[model samples]
Every structure is written in structure tokens, then in C-alpha cells.
Target chain A: MFGEFNLIDKYFSARQAQRKDVHLTLGDDCAIVKAPDNVRIAISTDTLVAGTHFLPEANPAWVAHKALASNLSDLAAMGATPAWVSMALTLPHIDEAWLEPFCHAFFELANYYNIQLIGGDTTKGPLSITLTVQGFVPQDKVLLRNQAKVGDWVYVTGELGDSKAGLDVILAPEKRQEPFAAELEQRHYLSTPRILAGQALLNLASAAIDISDGLISDLGHILHQSQVGVSLDVNCLPMSKELRQFAPSIQVAQQYALTSGEEYELCFTVPAQNKGTLDSALAHCGTKVTCIGQIRPQGVFELLNNGQKLDWALSGYDHFKEVK
Target chain B: MFGEFNLIDKYFSARQAQRKDVHLTLGDDCAIVKAPDNVRIAISTDTLVAGTHFLPEANPAWVAHKALASNLSDLAAMGATPAWVSMALTLPHIDEAWLEPFCHAFFELANYYNIQLIGGDTTKGPLSITLTVQGFVPQDKVLLRNQAKVGDWVYVTGELGDSKAGLDVILAPEKRQEPFAAELEQRHYLSTPRILAGQALLNLASAAIDISDGLISDLGHILHQSQVGVSLDVNCLPMSKELRQFAPSIQVAQQYALTSGEEYELCFTVPAQNKGTLDSALAHCGTKVTCIGQIRPQGVFELLNNGQKLDWALSGYDHFKEVK
Candidate 1:
């Protein structure tokens, strides 16, 4: 008859922190959190499933990291500072070995971001994780996709397509059996560093979105929401040297960079006046911020190669599409 | 191919009232919610599985209602006003018939509480639902179980054991099939009303918690967190007449009232001076508030019958326990 009390005390009770904003935490019906006076809260949610989102044998630590990081990236896109989170975990059974590393990784990231695990629910089912995160931004400071005005310069943080290259190595390990492929495999397993740069660009950027569904597809979200279009130079798409070397061809590499997902980088639009400020911020943060394209009044997305228009073959990874 | 945009627009988007606190809602990477100065946010999450929490054939509307209502009850217990919610839904397949009713019931309750569904994630899997609800309360006004003190009077809203009685009717439909047994069965499918009564009691009450894992078990949480003890009157335990009529004996009815989970009523403690104010608030709310026990100096919880202590069972529903 081990009831909710014993289960909570045994597994989750002591792991919480004592904070001024946390009036109540684990062992109660719900947890309470205090918000700062001048900050608005940003929230996002994501769910990951075994077999669908990750391999069954993937490290539980990585699984925990990726799940929380993915949701946090959404907050970053909105130029919000990480604050708190709640997790709902469903598992086939409780395995102590798996729970230890999973909790360690989860708490490590949470502590790094100063985010508290305020509340959660646990149940028995196939392995799945759902995370909802709360973040804070000054009033009216949130970056929104609909705010991208025509002539705003589009920029992306960090190199793209590395995750896609990593995925290729994982899906076809035998095809890339060369010794140098291990680095590619690591990229797929560990996601990109979160774009904390959005915090600095909050006042400067007109619109922003996280790169989770490839450059072309996620950029489409900003375009559709802002009721505008874009014309990107294909050569301008940033890629890691490691990604270029592992890719099958230059065209294939370009296509993967345009359509790969899980990069966790920020794609934002800044006014021309703020270009120097953005460059200075990026240099101070030691992260690359590339100006890839600009917003246009037209309603169509276009790609140009060597100053000539090229027909794009793929849009991005669509969830309902037949897997390639 | 279905991507994130159409998935959200077609299935998740809805017209919600423009909340003064919400700067932005769905269709963005994250939702922007304003938190006023001097207000603390309370957050909680819960997940429901098809076969474990409800029958597979359960009404979709009730399933959706119970899922969100149960989480909202946690907010009510903390005396927090509902503000935002996000859902994670996994389904074997999409059925329009099921989705329409489910969404209707879900949105109906959300509207009633003025809580908006700001964001969510949907995927294919076994039928499961995870909901995270956000609530706001004035700074220093949030109720917590740890604030209860010795000499405080313990109280509860609404009767207990009706849900368990309803479950009995559902589990054994053929035993002495009474007229309106179908109505009794409906109770199992329906959710308990949240006791918004806590909002009025926040100033008067010393501490509070929602009774989801029965009165005795849930009170233990408050006791443990507050470092206090309780002496409950077994004769004062409230139960519906229908529950007593259906139970095998008075002791069984008492046990059910003390140990059944899913009541969703609030259990709270208040200073002796505020008893009159408590009566007025409950009266104005049109709900019954009963004083069944009192807080005591640190010790084990006890049950008294006619001024004499009685040995009682301490057990309730544990989600991870194996069914007999």
C-alpha cells in the first residue's frame, strides 16, 4: 500500500531546493513559485517518446538533457531568462540505475540555468518525457515572429547542419565506418548550445525563432507569422567544416543544412542600426552571429546559388512525411 | 506532410479571451505571460493514462475534463488564480469524434477558470495526457501546507468517498442492479468541483492542501510538512448517504472516506479566531466546509472515537503499486 507520500519522499522529495520564491514544493498538492516584479513569464512545452524521438537504448542522461534543452530553446527564441520547469515522466518501470543518471543530468542543467523543478507527475507507461518550462522577460520585451518587418536583417547564431550530419552518421553507421565519423555521431547525440544571445538582442530584434525544424522550414515560420517572405543566398548558409567533409556532396550538404532540425540556434531579425551592436554582443559572448538574409515584401521564399535562382527540392522535415 | 504549423493551427489553436497578463499566446515558439508586481506564480503538472486512470471506453469529454480539473484543483488548494495551461497529448490515432468532445470539455473548463491553453505538444503513442497549469497568487498570500501550526482548526470542503462509491458501481454493474445505478456510474466518469473556497480563506487559513489521496493520507502531507500532528474524529468523517448505503458496513464507509483517492476537495487549517469568517466565506460560496479535526503538537496522526483513540489503517492509492 505504498501511497503517494512514500513514493514522493523516497524518489523526489529531497532533490528540491529551498528558495525565496518557492513557498511550497514537493509533498504538497502543488508547488508555488514567485515571479519577479518587472518581468513577464514565457512558457513552452514539449514531449519526447521512445522510438519516436529517441532510440530505446539511448543514454538516459542525454535523453533528459535533450528534452529539457529543447523546451528551453523555445524560451531563448522569445528572449526570456530561464526560471522554472515541471516534468511529467511516464515509464514502463522504475529502474534505479536509469533514474540516477537521468536525474543528475536533468538537475545539472536546471541548476546551471538557475531553474527550479517546481512540480511534476509520475506514472507507469511506455518511456516518455514531457517538460514545461517558465522563463522571464521584461514587459513588452519578448521577441515575436509576427513582429518581423520588411527590410529587417535576418541572422542565425552558430553553424547549422551539424546535427543533420550527425543524424546521417547514426542512421547509417556502416556507410560512414571511417574513423573520423565518431565526431559526427557525437553531434547528433548532443544538441547545440542554447542561444542565450537572444537575451542581449531582445531590445534590438524585431522577430526571432529557434532553429528546430531546419533553416528553411523554421525560417518559414517567421515569414508566415510576419506575413512576409525571404530570399536567401545558398552560399551564405553556415556549416561546420566537419559537416562539409562528411556530407555526400556540396548540393547534399547545402540541402541538409537548409532542412536539418535540432540545432537549437536562434534565427532573428535585427534593424540595420543594431548590426554593430549585435556584432559586438556576439564577439563578447564568443559566439558567431551570421546575417543570412533579409525580410522582403513579397510572399514567396526564394534561394539563390552563385547569383542565379535555383529550384529547391526539399522544404524541411515534416512530421507526417514519409521518412527519407 | 504535416509540420508543426498546421498541427497547432488545426488541432490546438482556439480563440481565448485577451488576458491583461498575456502579451502573446499560441502560434509563437513560446507564450508570453505577464506577472504583476507582488504576485507569485504557482505551477503544477499531472498525467493521466487510458487504462490505468480511466477505462479505455470512458467518455472523451469526461476524460479531458478530469485531466485538466484535477490539475486545476491543485491550484485552487494553493489559493492561486488559474492563468495558463499547456497540454501534451499522445494518441494511437486521431478520431474526430473523440477530439471534438475532448477539446470542447477541456476548453469549457479552461474558460470557466479563465485559464488559457497557451502551448502544447502532440504525438502518436498510447492514449495519454499530461497537463501543466500555471496560477498566480499575491506575494506572501500563497497558502502552503508547511504553515499549519499547533492549535489550528482543520477543515475540509465537500464530502468524501463519493468517487470511490462511484467506482464501485462501475466495477460491479451486475450486483443488485439498483435503479439509477447508471447515474451512480456517471459519477465515476465525472470530476469533482474545485473548491475555489481557498481564495477567500487565504487570509484566514494557516495552511492548506488538496485532498486527492484521501483525507487521512493527504493530511499526513500537511502534518509532515508543517511539523505538526492531527487528531481526527472518526465519527466526524463526512460521507454521502449513497456511499454509506452502498458500503458493506459503517467501518468500511469510514475507511473509504479516509483512504479513497481522487476527491479533489481542499483540506485546510485556520486560526480559531477566524472560524466565523470561515463560515461566512463557505456560505457565500454555496459550499459546505466542515471542521473534522485539529492540529496538535508534533506526533503521529491519530483518530479519536467518542473521546477515545482508535487504531486505524493508514493506506491509500499509490499509482506505482501493482494491482491485486
Candidate 2:
């Protein structure tokens, strides 16, 4: 036990500098965090099981980064500034080599966002990680999915489908690697940029959600919550060149673009009147914001290809569905 | 997925009314909570895996209560007020019967403490629960385990060793039902009352920790952190009459008393000068505060028996150690 503690102290403890808001940190049974006045705290939690979320032999650094980034994306979706996070990590054994890179990458992302590692539990079990992240939002300014209204234009940040293309390469390394396979793999490992674009869109977007379960499925959440529907332009779906190159067919590329999971970009709705301002904010943030659809009064989702409606075989990734 | 969502709405949603500090409750990616002025939030998290933490056949309600209570005890140790908690539950299947009672007991405790269920993630996996709890403490009055000084009186709330005694009954139901095993079995199901008494002692106690990994091991943490030692009166170790009757011998009961885990009582250090005030506060809270021994400058943990120090065979429960 002391060996484990010392290992954690030697490698992970000082990797990230303590933020001013953290009154007390890791060495205690719990941690103390101070929240400034007039700031609402947004909190979200996510758990990743080894076999379910990532390959057992996947790079530990990327695993750590992706796990933490997934939860941070939730904070970003809420238009909140990342503040602190508590990680509950359970592992079958402690590998110093794995711990070193994992902790380094974990803290690198944490420090980049100025988020403090407040508290958590480390125990022995199947490799699993549960992270509860806290973020701060100015009073009356937090974003939600239920706020979308009719005539609001739907927009997304960054390209989608690239992550899924990357994951394909990761899960099946034996397959012949395409010219863009390496690039796709890199996207799979690194998470989408979040805090900056989210902060810039906070005042402009009416409703927003991070695209985790692909664009279509995740967008369905916003539509359901807001009691609205959407008419999406299939041709407007964002796709990286790497995804297009690796996709077996145009249909497959479109399917992956619409339904691939682990893409942490934000899909949001904004009134037509605020489009100019939204565009300006995106430009200032230096992030791509593509208008792909519009919320409608009728509660039905439709996809238009060129001038005719088309049916896509797959809607989005569902945990219960058979994996492709 | 919708079924699980409905179950959550039915069972967990209404309980939000019990918490006054919650600005926004469930149904969002994250929950928002407000901290009172002059109070710093104390946070802790714990993950309990099925088979590791409890028997697979254990009642769901008890499992839920124990999971939340264990984390809540961390707040109690710091003399903080329980404010909110988020629970992540992963299970192989969704059984309505299991969820109903589990949520019932969970909210019962949450409502009693006014700790709201803010936000969490639910997914399909091995039966496991991760609970992150938040508590509030006056900025200057948070109790820590590194403040104990030489000569401070060592005190503990409630009786110890019952949970371990209860485990004995769980391991052998037939023996558990024999003669005096009924009460021990009952103790296994219901947990120790959290020490609300600690709130008043926050300013009086030098250092504190919750007794989870038995008295000997858990108190050692305080001693190690504070750079002090302790002399415990073995004869003064508290055990329920039921535990004594069920044990094979007094020595066995003593061993269990010193080494059992899951006793969620606060173990604290207070200056001898503050003994009277501490006694009064415990009495007012209707909880027992037993002065078991005193803190020493530096030495090995000593067990005083018949006015002479005696060697004890078993140390406290070490998670990494093989079970006897």
C-alpha cells in the first residue's frame, strides 16, 4: 500500500499545479474546494470500464486523456468553465510505466483547463475510472438542451466521424492502413478542443449538447428535451478528409459521420437573428462552426440529400446495439 | 434506455425537494448546487463493486444505503454538513423491484440529511456504484487529521466492531441465527449512526478521521499524519453486548473491535482542556463520545491491558491484505 502511495506521490502528485480554488487536495480523505460568489457550479460524472470503453492494451495516456475529456465535454456543453475533478480509479494492478504516462497526460489536460484534481478513491479491481467534474457558470448563463425553440438553426463545432474512423484503425490494427489511417488514429487518441469554443458560444446558443453518441443520436436528445424537430441537410454533415478516404463507400462515410461516437464537438441551436454574432464568436475562437440543420415546429426529424429526402440505415451509436 | 430514465424520474426525481441548496436537480448533463456564504465545500468519493464490497445476494436497499453512508461518513469526519451527492450506478440488468427499494432507502437517507441527488450516470455493466458526496464547513473550522498534538484526548463516537460481527453472520447464516447472532446480523444490514456530534467539536478537536478500517488502522492514519502516537485502553474498547455474546472469546471480540472495517464513527482528538465541552456536545447530540485513550508525542501504538501494555496479534483491516 505504501508502495502504491509513494508511486502516486512520486509521479502524479506534482504533475499538475494546484489551483487557487482548491483549499485542500489529494492527501486527505476528501478535498475542499471554494466556489466564488455569483458563480453556479455545474457537475457531471462518467465511468469507463476497460473492455467496454477501450482496448486493454491501448495507450494508457490516451485512455486517461479520453476519460477525463469526456466528462469535461459535459461541462463544456453546459457553457461552464472547468474548475475541479475527482477521479475514482480501480485497477487490477499498479504498473509504474503505465501510471507515469497516464498521470502525465491526465494532469496535462487538467492543467491546460486550470482544473484541479480535488479528491478521489483508488482501489483494486477491474480497470475502471469514474470521474466527477465540476465547472463554474456565471449566474443565469448556464446552457441547457431544453432551451431550443422553433426556427433556431442547428450548428456543430469541428468535423465529426473522424473519431470513429480513428477507432476502426485502433480496434483492428491488422487491417491494411490507408494513407489517412494514421491521422484518424491521432484524432481518436486526442479529444476535441472544448473550453474555448464553449465559452464563446455560451451567450449565443439557445440549446447545446456535446456530440458523444454521434451527431444524429445526440441531436435527438436536444430535440426531445426542447420539444422540437429538425430538418438536417445530409450534404452539410462535417467529415474529415481522412474519414472520407478510409470509408468503404459514400454511404458508409455518411453513416460514420452521422453516428460515430467519441466525437466531443458541441452540437447546438441558435436563433437566425444571432447567426452573425455566432459566426463572429466562432471566428474569434478560431473554431469551425457549420450550420447543418434547423429546428422546426413539428416534432419529426428529416434528412435531405440534395433536394430529396433520404433514409440512413443507422441513426447513431447505441450501447445496446451490436457494434459494427 | 427510456425505461431506465423513467425509473429514475419516478424514484429519484421527487426526492430533490428535500435539498434546499440545490439550484438545479436531475435531468441535465450536470447538476448545479449553491454553497452558502462562509462555507467551504468538502467532497469525497467512493466506489463499491459487487462481490468485492458486498455479497451478490445482499438486499439492494441496504447496498444503496451503505454505499452513500460510507461516503457521507467522510463529511462527518471533517465535521461538515451533508449537502449533496451524485451516484453512478452500473448494472447488468435493470430490475424494477431492485431499483425501487434501492432508490427508496437511498433517498430516505438523502432526505434525512437533506443531501440531494444532484446528477449521475447510469449504464450497463457489472453491478457497481460510485458515490461522490459534498458537504459544507465554515471556512476556518474544517477538521483535519494532521492537527493532533501530544496529550490530546482520543475520543470515538458510537460503539465499534459491530459491522465486522455482522459480516460473520452474513458468511454463515445458520450460525448467525444461532442464539445471539440475530442482532449482529441486523447490524450488518443497518449502519452506525453518523456523528452529527462532530459539528460542535469542529473547533474543539485538534484532528479527526472516520473509523472505517477499524480503530487500530484508521487511527494510525491520524497518528501518522499528525506525527504523533496513541495509547489505547484495550479494556475500554467498546463492543455491543450482542457482539461479545456471539464471539468465541473476549480476546476474539477485542481483536474484532480493534480490526473490523465499516464502523462509520468519528474518531477525533481534542485537548484535555476541552473535555467538558466535548462531553456536553455529545450528550446534546444524543450520541456517546468515549475517551478511549490519549495522544502521545511519538511511539508505536500501545494497547494497555490491566495497566500494562500487551501485544495484539491482529492489526486493523488492510484492503490489500489477505482476509483471515
Best by TM-score: 2
Tell me the TM-score that candidate 2 gets on chain A alone: 0.94
lDDT of 2 by residue, B204-311 (tens): 899988877778777877887888878888788878888888788988888888888788888889998998787766667888778889988666466788789877
Candidates' C-alpha lDDT: 0.78, 0.81
Residue by residue across A1-324, what tens digits does model 1's lDDT show? 123455556656666555566766776667777777778888999888887777777788888888888888898898888888888988877777887888888887777777788778888877899999988888757788888887889898888888878777777858477654777666665664454687888878999999887887787777777788777777888888787887778888888888888888888998888877877766665668888888787455667887788786786533212211
DockQ, prediction 2: 0.67
| Colliding residue pairs in candidate 1 | none
Candidate that scores best on DockQ: 1
Per-prediction DockQ comes to: 0.73, 0.67
The per-prediction i-RMS, to one decimal, reads 1.1, 1.0
* lDDT tens digits by residue: candidate 2, A13-125: 77767788888887776799889988889999888877777877878999999989999999988889999999888777887788888898999889888888887877766
